[model samples]
Target chain A: MKCDFCRETSVIHVRHTDKWFCEEHLVASVEKKVLETVQKTFMINRNDKVLVAASGGKDSTNLLHILHKNFPKVEALFIDEGIKNYRERSKSFIKKFCKKHKITLHTSSFKEEFGTTTDQIVKLDSTKTSPCSKCGVLRRYLINKKALELGADKLVTGHNLDDTCQDILMNIFQFNMEKLARTKSISPGFVQRIKPFRRVSERESMAYSIIKGFESNEGACPYVSESFRSLIREELNDLEFKFHGSKVNLQMIFDRLVPNLEKKVMKNRLNKCENCGGPTSRKVCKTCQILEQLK
Target chain B: MVTLEYPDGAKIKVEIEGSLLKVLVKSGENPEEIIVKKDGKMIAEDYELKKEDVVQIIKVGSKG
Candidate 1:
């Protein structure tokens, strides 16, 4: 089939927009969408240093590439969860990509910072809490600490539309309004976090990565299936398959709801964690609390 | 004839002058499980299709 804009054979058809594009147009379209999101959100300033949290996956890889291409000051931070096969494979890819792009890459590991790997922590857990729950808290804590130390003006993540929408649905299903409020695009007293691909879907990111010739690691973590998120993700996918545009509609509804929800529910003051000296809503941060349990 | 493109690079040709839903059904796609878009705008099931309209049929699902 011919591309909608040019004579090149079309490679992708975006159904939500009814647009067909060849390789060049598809890459341009993806980059254009990300740039539009960043501009619309006022996510970055001219002098700001953007620290991207990359996991060597398609979403983060595409994010790093796009942000580096557009922004003058962009670097990457990778969290080594030490999940055996996954961490090493992803790290190799990240190192190679960053080196090739001439972007400075920072590395932090759970074992080095917390004295235990995610795999170790999961094995030692007495509470039936999913490993993802613990790993997420630790990863966020470490990333925040590292970003501040690096004096970054903003933190960028590769959370695509699917991840954002799934989190929203999960929070609603669990009746966790405070968690939902925290999902707002901005929060005071924290490094301004931006998700430039919040409107882009996962499939699009993978396609973009391939089309752009990015060598990304596509392996899934072994513990991925243990999270409630995995369940929600599957259900959302099923719903979307049955109802086209369902995911995009869900995200649109979330974007409309988050601002008001933040005002109403995100009232918890940021308190300094007594142990780690990081900002948290509680006295001892969730990370500190988890560390205490692991000890 | 309207050409419908799937996610896996598969294309289906259908001859339908009615709504997008009719074309989707003719292409052997479950109308409920597919999203149809023409000219980069999502068209409802009742959206009319003209000759040579390139309808992109995206299955509503993501691996996140």
Candidate 2:
């Protein structure tokens, strides 16, 4: 189909808007929305030490590239979860991308920080402990710890509109009101998190990476199908298919509810986990609890 | 006869006469999660299939 704005053949069909865009316009559209997201939310300052959580996935890779374009000093952090044949490939891509762009990148690992790899954790596979669960907790813990150590003013992620919608739906279904409220809430000893792609769709992010010639099709986590989030992702995609703009609508509803939710849900004041000195609402943080279980 | 090409180099031959979107849906693929290409150029979902047309289906962001 022809691009709505130009003579070039359209490569992207933004369903909700029913608009077609060529490569140039597609990039411009996604970047414009991201820039607006950052500005509208007051997400960063000119001198902020911005660190992007890069996994070499389409989302993060796109995020890192976009942030670096706007903020030349933006660096990236990669966490090797030690997944066999998976994390390594992603790390290699991230390393090459950083070197090419001259952006300093930081590296951490589950092996170094937790004394165990995700591969090892899955082998032990306690009946009550899902490997995905452990990996999620540990990954979040390490990212925050690494971000804090790097003295990053803002920790940015590649979370897109579809991912954000999935998270909101999961939290609502699980009655995780506090978890939802505290997702972006400021707390001591933690780097503030921001998602520039929160309003951009996943497919658009993939298209941007492809058009930029840096998209990696490999490195999908082998155990992704085992997670509850995968199911939520599928369901949300189907809903979005049946009704365009469903994901954005869900985010709009959640955004309106969050101000009140934040006020109502911060009752469990966070305390430092004695073991890790991380912020936690409980006596011990979920990361510490997961680590103990692994042991 | 139309040939469907996947990124993994797998090809499937199907005798279908409809829009690319319909053929994809019939094959149990989600239209939202994929982009189709003809002659190395991206094509819209509603692009109609021709006899013996070979189109590349590049799976997009979604795992589904």
Candidate 3:
């Protein structure tokens, strides 16, 4: 097979666009898409200090690489949930990659900040809550705190097309319109969040990682099996298989609907958490509340 | 003849020269999770196969 753009052999076939690309063209296309997404969404400004949430996974590794290459000032922030074997192994790759690229890397751990790891939290809670539910709260809290302390203008995440589509579907399935609206591109009282790969597929990210020789962590989190997001991801993948471009269309619908939903949901005033002074809609932040439960 | 390689390192040889979709269907592989690439370039399903073309069908999706 030949590349659609040239006589060179094709390396990637994007089904939705019915295009073939050579290695050079494939890399160009992926980078162009990322740049386009960031530009069209107004995800970043020329002088912004971007803090990338690097997980050492394929998506985050790719995100960090793309952002560092394109942006003027970029740094990596990693939240270590203290998952045995997983966190340690993932951090090593993050450290090496950052060092190799000469990008500044900052890390915060649950053990150091909260005096407890996710593993211990899981074992100690009598409610038997899903580990992901607890882990996500703690990780988000720490990430936000670090981003703020580091004076980042925006916090960039590795959320790809599949993940964003799954999240929209999950919220719709649960009929949580408020939560869905909060997933919009910009929100108040929080460091702006951006997803440059919001239009890129997970497979595309993986292929890019392999082609670029990024030392991405290949292991899965131990608690992922019990998360509802995993189930939604599987279902979305099945739907995308049955109907090509389903994920893309889902994200498009979400993008169009978010503005209207935000108008309705934005009325709920956000308040500062008395404990950590973080933005919270309730009397206490979710992170502080979770910490209280642990205590 | 065209060669299709799966993620498991299994290879299937096809004598037919047609689009990537036809090749995938002939190989009995699910097109959803499988992406076809030739010489490390992603090809669309409509890409016509030429003789001696070696294509890799990578299985891609969200990992746990």
Candidate 4:
């Protein structure tokens, strides 16, 4: 496939947009969006300590770059999910990137903290579910915990527009009304979780990375390569090809519908988990359940 | 174990035991807003405790 920008025969067909992009353009676009996100919402102070959740992927790698470009107080927190070579390599990339930028990077391992990696969790389970669910819960808990541990005020995530859209689509599909209500919105907790790249597209993030000459691991997680998210992405990609600007259109539609959606679909009283007392829609929060499963 | 009620009169007679293993109950209810408290120190319903645990469950509602 010819790249949309470079017209190179070697191109990756992004499943959400159905556009083939050369590696360079892809990285450049991602960087641009990342920059835009950071500029719009993130106001950095000299004394502020920022904790960035880096996954060694393009989105995160570019986020680190943008944060460093505009702010001086950015550090990274990488949670090693204990996925064997996959995690080791990702961790190494983070270490190298941190060293190059001279940013203080802190590392946490699931094996050390929880006695398991996402791979181990998936291996021990028979459900064949995406480890992302477990990894996500662990990652979130640790991110918040570590952010507080490191005395950081805000926890920045590499969630881009496509990620947000996927979540929106997933919530809609699952009838997750409460999650739908807070889609793309930020809230505070013990540690504030913010997405500077929430408005950036995946493709744009990739492009931004290339333009800035940042190196990112091209390897996808072995388990996530065939995950349901990718399948949904492909489905969305097909839709976008049939109707250009579907993502933007979908975002518009969601923006209009979410007010009513929150009322009609998610009007149920919000609950606090009895276990951790965190915000939950059920009696037990998802984090406590995963911890229960691990135990 | 305490018998707590939902707004729809859905009462769950739970026995708070020794150790709490968090369980996500299947319901049309929002999981985040379900309040679990025992003896004025908030706890999950699955919290394993003694025999005489005073548990109260609260639900979020619209003020307007």
Among these predictions, the greatest TM-score belongs to 2
RMSD after CA superposition, every candidate: 6.8, 1.7, 3.9, 21.6
DockQ of candidate 4 against the true complex: 0.01
Stretches off by above 4 angstroms in model 1 are B1-64
Off by over 4 Å in 2: B62-64
Indicate whether candidate 1 or candidate 4 has the larger lDDT.
1
3 or 4, greater by DockQ: 3
TM-score of decoy 4:
0.68
lDDT tens readout by residue for model 4, A1-295: 5577876643334444556665566666565655665556554455678889998887777778778777768899998877776778778888899999898899988878878778778878766667777787777877777888899976788776667667788877887777788654444454666777766665555445544666676466777764667666656655654565677667768878877766665555557789977766679978788878766
Candidate 4 residue A139 Cα shift, in angstroms, is: 1.6
lDDT tens digits, residues A1-295, model 1? 5788999766555655567677788788889999999898788997899999998888888999999998999999999987988889889999999999999999999989989998898888999788888899899888888998899999989998878988898889999888888876455557878889988877667667766778877756788777888888777766765676888898888888888998898777777888877888888989899999977
Q: Taking the tens digit of each residue's C-alpha lDDT, what string does model 2 give over A4-32? A: 99998787788867889898999999999
Off by over 4 Å in 3: B1-31, B34-64
- Looking at model 3, residue A192 earns an lDDT score of 81
DockQ of each: 0.07, 0.46, 0.33, 0.01
lDDT of 3: 0.82
Error of model 4, residue B61, in angstroms = 42
DockQ of 1: 0.07
lDDT of 3 at A4: 84
